[model samples]
Target: MAQRDYAMSGADARRAVETGLAAAEWYHTDIPRKEMKALMARADQPAIRDTGLLFGCMALFAGLGIALWPSWGSAPFWLAYGVLYGSAMDSRWHECGHGTAFRTRWMNDWLYQIASFCMVRNPVQWRWSHARHHTDTIIVGRDPEIQAMRPPALGRIALNFLGLLDAWQGWTKMLRNAAGRLDPDEADYVPEHEAPRLIRVARIWVAIYAATIALALATSSLLPLMVIGLPRLYGAWHHVMTGLLQHAGLADNVTDHRLNTRTVYMNPVSRFIYWNMNYHIEHHMFPMVPFHALPRLHDRIRADLPAPSPSILAAYREVLPILWRQLRNEEHFLTRALPPTARPYRAELHRHAPGVPAE
Candidate 1:
């Protein structure tokens, strides 16, 4: 099969969409999203192994503290530890949710569960929502993940600035809403499966996470109790803020394969923080493509993707201007869409690495 060619620029992105959407089989294909992801090249072994160990260590020690000695300090180190581990765990969960962390499906689920210990958010729940994200990312009204912050307009800026705090508050509010207390319709979560066994697992997920919270309240001091809240906020905002720089308000409102994903020109600092997720367009086009593999993929396929609008760091800086425009209601978000390409972009893989062609 000939490689698909891509034209660079927001204009080319749009064309890719028209081409894809025009295809008769697109809507009817039975290819599962998971299989599509796995078809990408394998992830880098070193990065995957190292990250797993690091997060694993953090989770282990934190769990020990939470269980054995809940009051070693007045400030609640366990709480702080929980937050840090929670954030890192969520990162692992994100990777595992894609089934890229480990080769075995059951192993990935177990790893995801460990990460979920502090988080308590059921891995299954996230998997279902996330699968939808991969399928209909960035589509307005259709993609459940894409939505304006409440109160809309000016409130969006305020919400982003409040950053982590807003995320923490939202989580708390979600717990409240789940109990029929508050209404955060924007969160938009739906049950994943209805099988009795699945429901039983979901109940266990709820129980374990709730037990962690209960343990904190019973054993830790007031200061420690506050620490538990910090992880939820930090992880939520860290993920969102990074994503905002990644593709938020950057792509056109369309949901085609290429246009839905984006790349952010990034600096070394941001790169480390984002774990190479900055090459989001590459990731989306090839979801199974691991973080470490993105650079290689980019070098191969750069000509096909939209030319770097701004480096990731530059993109973050530019977001303020975009936010201002959004605040003024000029645009809901600052997203770019590509125009059509004359031909699909292909890389000469064997030229550089033995089998890896430049796309």
Candidate 2:
């Protein structure tokens, strides 16, 4: 079996383009144009309500954490605060990046910038990166965001729960970008014209971080960091947990999202934190649909797609075994069985690595 090369400049990436997996037309469940338009319509109310509540709760938590600091009573408040800072900001950044979070364009841009800062993502760089993600998701060498590669490094996944790897890499990238350097992969996708804006944002972030660290030094207390820098590390678990389910153990280089993405049913709290991204297939199929509208879109399209995993736990159950098997057979992945009401997989376009046996 061939070991998967996930580099943008690797042989597998060349194969992906040659095999028509790069920028190829993907299968989206047929939805009437009128209904899709309704679903895609932008609205500010839902996002406004959610954003207010999210930040409101974060404020309450952060205040309590500060008041009760130097006491173990502050522990829970800090923990709650971290998830909002570390995890929830991720989805906020994501939705706002798509420009569907608010009916007003400026609202979306404002939130995208704030959330991008909290998450250490260069707004200009990630905006283009995410566009590429939608264009060629899970296509090795083309998609920059394939988190779980073949022969999954379970250790790396574990470390990321504490934001040890991803956040640190993000900070390093910010520093490099601050120095006006674009790594090869970033340069490939990010527009040359946007480099200045990306660099400017990175420098601003570096300044903010340096100030935050300097404040900690001046205060002789870790308090400032707990609110700013520390939460990203301490509260990274929830996002890491949910993020891995997006494409881990799914077929790569497939034109169909059902073949690459998994949607799991989650509770209200998780839904709120995730911004309804649990409706993964629907979101991918119709990227224009707002996060608030994903559930309705999912309802309209689920019949044409594989059934969603019943819950987050169930999805991990389904994915973990396949990842374990892929340790030996890199081609190994779960070909999710579609319900009878769903259309069949586009087997013709399901490009597997050469020499891999079809199930």
Candidate 3:
């Protein structure tokens, strides 16, 4: 496998455009119009109920942790709080950024902003970034959100478990945005008109973070930082764990989601934290469908898609080794075998493509 640059400004990005891969049409499972409409329909009730429960749990965990502060007994409560505040917010930012999480526009916007802050993502920049992600799925140069680039940066991936690399890059970008200068790659996806708003948002985020740090210093305690800033580091493991399963070892520059995405069946608790994104292929195929409706959408398209991994453990069992091999072989990737009941992969479409070998 030839080493290809995954940077937006790199050769692969240019090749993608020249080869007509960037923004190319993607494969989708067809559904009846009425059924698709129903699936895409947004409702406030489900999001409201889920949001209430999420916040309620966060509050309970935080209260317990704070009351038992400076003790080992607080560890469990803080751990729960960290997962909710740090890890769970990643999914919330994602779904709400799609504007499909809630029927109400303001509700989605509000949560998107809040969750973006929790995850240390710039809401404005990430909105367009994710739009590009869906539009270009796993196309190396075109997709900004490819979690693990080939010849995997294993050290960065390891540090990202604690949110170190991600946070460092995010804060650096935030500072750059606050200075009203967009990095070239970011400028590629984020519109020129949105630049001002991105700057303003970044400035606000910097202020809030500064305030949190100041409060922590003033109190001579870690409570404030733990509440606001540190959870993103401590609680990031779960989301990173689930998120890497999304596209880590999958084929890239392919039109088919079944080839580039994994759908893992996760437990109910994981489902809640991940906002049901484990139905990843379903979400990618029909991104308009609300998160609450993904399970139903999965059922509707199950016969047309690759069989989902039975569990998170099952997914890792397959992905981890592929990732390790990819360290030595950039072309090494998992070709998800589809059930006979599922539609055949679009092998002919990618037969001549470099780096994307047919299974």
Off by over 4 Å in 1: 1-39, 56-86, 116-120, 147-192, 195-202, 220-229, 256-260, 265-273, 309-312, 330-359
lDDT of 2 by residue, 235-261 (tens): 989888998999898888778898889
* Per-residue lDDT of candidate 1, residues 1-359 (tens digit): 12212222234334434544211121111235665454465544745565666666556655666566536642354544543454555556677778776666676677677665445444544566566566655433334445332113445534544344444444554355344342322233344232333345545544554666787678765434344444554334445556665544443334433443557766664464456777877776667766666787776666555665477556666555555554444234442433353123222211111111111
Residues 1-359 of candidate 3: C-alpha lDDT, one tens digit per residue: 45878789898899889988888888877788999999999899999999999999999999999899979999999999999998999999999999999999999999999999999899999999999999989887889999888878889888998999898888899999999899999999999999999999999999999999999899999998878989999999999999999988888878888988999999999999999999999999889999999999999889888778999999888888888888777887878778888778876646424453423
lDDT of 2: 0.88
Better of 1 and 3 by TM-score: 3
Model 3 CA lDDT for position 314: 94
Candidate 3: segments with Cα more than 4 A from true spot: 352-359
RMSD for all candidates, in order, please. Answer: 10.7, 1.5, 1.4
After TM-score superposition, what is the CA distance of residue 167 in candidate 2 from its true location, in Å?
0.5
**Candidate 3 local distance difference test against the native:** 0.89
What are the models' TM-scores? Answer: 0.63, 0.97, 0.97
